[model samples]
Target: MVLTGWASMLAVFAVEFLSLLYLGTLQDEAVMGAVGFGSMTQFTITSVCIGVTVGGAALVSRALGAGNLLRARTLAGASLVLMAGAALGAAAVFLAAIAPFTAAIGLEPDVRAHLLSYVLITTPFAVVMGIGMMLSNLLRASGRGRQSMWVLLAGTATVAVLDPIVIFVLDAGMQGIAWAGGVGRLATVALGGWLVFGKHRLVDWPGRRALLADLAAIGKIALPAALTALATPAAVIFTVSTYATFGPSVMAGATVVDRVLQLAYSLYFVLPGAIGPILGQNLGAGQWDRVKQTVRLTSRWALLYGLGVATLLAVFAPRVADLFQVAGPGRDLIIFFCRYGSFAWALNSLFFVAIAVFNNLGYAAYSTMIGWLRATLGTLPFVWLGAHYGGAVGVLLGQTLGFALFSVIAIAVCSRVLRSPPTTDATARVA
Candidate 1:
């Protein structure tokens, strides 16, 4: 799971970074703007893709828990349907508005045109990306989390090489990047599907009717989980708008910080994702005691995460900043502060254990609420204040404040719940 998170990010950074360099070479502000703005679209696709995948997880987990292997298999069939639907939607959106989205994000003209071209080219293949997501989740739920990671790695390698080759060397331009992305996605999805559906029959054979039932089941689970997945990206858009108040360097710095945060948060993301199936299996088997132990253990893990990661971020901020090679002293300094802010980044991960526990128990509302707070209330206003008051540094300071606020509130709420007596079916039955 962690590897997928990281590899997914590798594709992002490599592509975005390359786009920025290409923009510099072209000396086009619009091009830079296009890359920066296009990120929102990328994030949007990823969030939706994740939401769709989680729906699959929820379905498989529940059906498996029900001790109905037949239903579980049926749910698997529905997963393919969802994948097809997602692909169709993605392709439609990408085809229709890829260029416009870039323009809307305020990309400069030449860059916007370039980005639009690329997005359009790859839009049809977005379905392939969605398929890969579904396949990966299916594997994970079937107790093959390791297989999912390998498939992701393979895709990442393909994109890692192809992105630069197609865009930079081949001079296929922005469109080339899209083609690369599509190729990698297709290869990954094909390979993963072969293993799970054919080699292992890990889930049910996907039939039309079976898939429909799975969709209905998934909708119930997905709404909450999908909302949770969206929180960060929504916060990002808010952060972007707020950073605009301070100017591009600040916005760029914040974006850089966001990228850095994404890279590191893979560590935090790991336990929550991996532990979900563990919790699912145990919950299904009616091992309430195991669930209790796991939740407590996972929460502690979240608590410990901030201090450890934050320390590392503080220590390595400068070195990390240098890696991106953003131009200009001002840009470099902006990135420098972003790296330094890694301390706050680490501290902010406290909610991980809490979130992990919530997700494992299928407590989507609680998870989604916290996520919404962090992204919406927690991040946006503070970033606005930073830009309005202190500039870039203030932005980081505001982020710290937001994280501290959210974490304190979460821990307090969680503690209150923990202090309350545990509820069990047996207890209810006795009552």
Candidate 2:
């Protein structure tokens, strides 16, 4: 499951890297900055959908483990509806508020225009992507990881094939990239819908009462999970707004490094999603020892993977900077991260693992609190200090140090949670 999940995430990141690479060839710093803003904003907005999937995956897996297929199906269908609603609502709110938000952040006019165009073209597709993501999570919860993997792989392939044609041949630029993403998401939704609703028959229409009950159950986890998911992007948005003070060059560099980090550590990023079902099912079955073992093994693997990737990133940092064509302060920032700051992710992976545990085991508020703590107290002061002391490089260093500190705290809390007696009620376990 981990390997397939990693591959699927890798494909997604590969497409992102390729898209950025193509854009870098244009040699427009403002355009790169716009990509940065657009991507982060999209992530922040879609986080609600991600949270819904967390809730869906946890409850649906538990339902299956408890031998309640009907409950699982109902939860799956309800989750999709909830996720779609959240996606559309988020996109609409963002579009309506983006002008003032961007103006408040003092984004440069050119980058702001590009950002608006990208968001306008892509926001409507959030529903498609959200529904597809819910189906993928449902598939995983139902032990169809391979099918979920295929759904993402198919979308990745579509983007890879269409990106250049739309961006270059059609001269669509940033908007073209947005269109490619929307079309790719459409492809995934089509495949995922077929697999979940047709082949697997894992989703079903829920009656009014069942729908309300499912929503209540899902909201318990999803609301906190959504807040938890929002924290990272919120932090990034703040960081990006701060970075804008430095220059477009710095934004461009930070953007490339962001893509590289996602691509390099795709395994760590996917670990939570991959292991979520395992943890949920085991907890549902009251297999406390197995759950503990899974946590231990996952932590070990995360550490190993993080260390190995950090080393590779350090070794090839310069080449990566060159490939992205980020020069001056931006280039320096990327190299510094590669050589030093990247190592922080080794510890940060622990934080990710701990979040998975909290979300799946009915301690979701813990995840939310931890996330916001890191985003605010853990992030803002350190980032300010780093930027004040070291400029763009310091910002990266500060963020790394803050995340490392929180990773330790998260793991400590996770240890205590695991030692507590397991919850007996299945619904309460998720609740």
Candidate 3:
């Protein structure tokens, strides 16, 4: 888990450089708002991947925990099939949605055209990322944390190495910028494929009936989770609308802040991800008490980690802001929003760990709701407020408020539900 943090710490170097873009320096708030929408083009894809990947992870983790190693491996084969489907969908979506989707962010004509072109060219990479993410999550749940991190390591390293060459030297412009990301993600896919297909060979030789069961299991859990993940990109759509009302700087700041927030989230990813397999296997083994302990310990760790990062942000808010962008007049507002908004989101460690536990314990419904709250319900109103009065700052407040509410409600729910996880696989199998 700590190594995962170290890996994430290293990731900042890559993320900082790749995130910034000029977009012709905020002519109107609408152009600024376009930053969020345009930026989400990738995330809308990634969020879809997350939603889908969670299904794969949940199924694979359960199989791994159940001591059905062969079954788990077979399910991985099924995942390859699903990822192929995702690739086809991504291509079509990009073709159909690129212009209109980019336009909806409401950027100025020139700015929207620039943004749309970037999205159109880069859309193919969405599926490449989908494959990598699915494999990584499968590995994570099977207790191969380092292996999963390694894939990201390769991708981030590739992106870091390629950014300047692609954008400036090759004169790819936004496409070049997008290419750096796409190429890096392609590297991740390659490495992940090696692990899943070449070395492990889990992604070969599938049984159609069993594969259908695997897909069904994944769909049951992932459907709601996917919807939950959609909330984030959807919220981005809403938040971008608000930032659009302000100016590009606000949207720029939000984009920058999201990078930092993602870096922060990598910490959450490390432990819960590591613990998910442990808890799943334990649940599969019927070791309910140990499953309980894993959740508690991971949550404690998450809290400690969140506090540590919050302290660092508080102490070095200005410097942190600078890493994302220049931090001008709106610097104060953006910094406040990002730093505090992250703090609130950070506290979700308890809930997040709890969600992982629920997934393993066969309460996928419990796990799914939090994603919905954060992405859909919580973020929506904040964007509305940010649009009406607060601007970017209002959205930050909305984000923080959403997490705060989740934290409170989750604690209450976790307290009651943690007492008992479902005892049998048959009972737990909602699918």
Best candidate, lDDT: 2
Name the regions of candidate 1 deviating beyond 4 angstroms: 1-33, 65-67, 90-115, 205-211, 245-251, 299-306, 328-339, 411-431
lDDT of each: 0.62, 0.88, 0.65
lDDT of 2 by residue, 14-52 (tens): 999999998887898889988987888778777888899
* TM-score (all chains, Cα) for each model: 0.82, 0.98, 0.87
lDDT for each residue of candidate 3 in 153-186, tens digit (9 for 90 to 100):
8888887777667655675545566777788888
Model 1 weakest 10-residue run by lDDT: 422-431
Candidate 3 global lDDT? 0.65
Candidate 1 colliding pairs: 30-108, 31-111, 73-204, 77-206, 78-211, 87-127
Arrange candidates by TM-score, highest first: which order?
2, 3, 1
Across 1-431, the per-residue lDDT of candidate 1 in tens digits comes to: 43454455455455445544543454433444444545655565666666667667655765677677777777777766766776587557656765554345564445456556656666667777778877877777776767777666667678777866765678775566667767888788878888887887866555566556558666655656667777866776665555544444444455555555655555665555556666666767777677667767665665576566666766776665555444453255444454556556555555665665555554556778998998878988898787678766776677667866886676566555544333563122111
Instruction: Provide the clash count, candidate 2.
Output: 0
- Model 2 residue 37 distance off true place after TM-score fit, in angstroms: 1.1
- Residue 333's lDDT within candidate 3 is 57
Best-to-worst lDDT order: 2, 3, 1
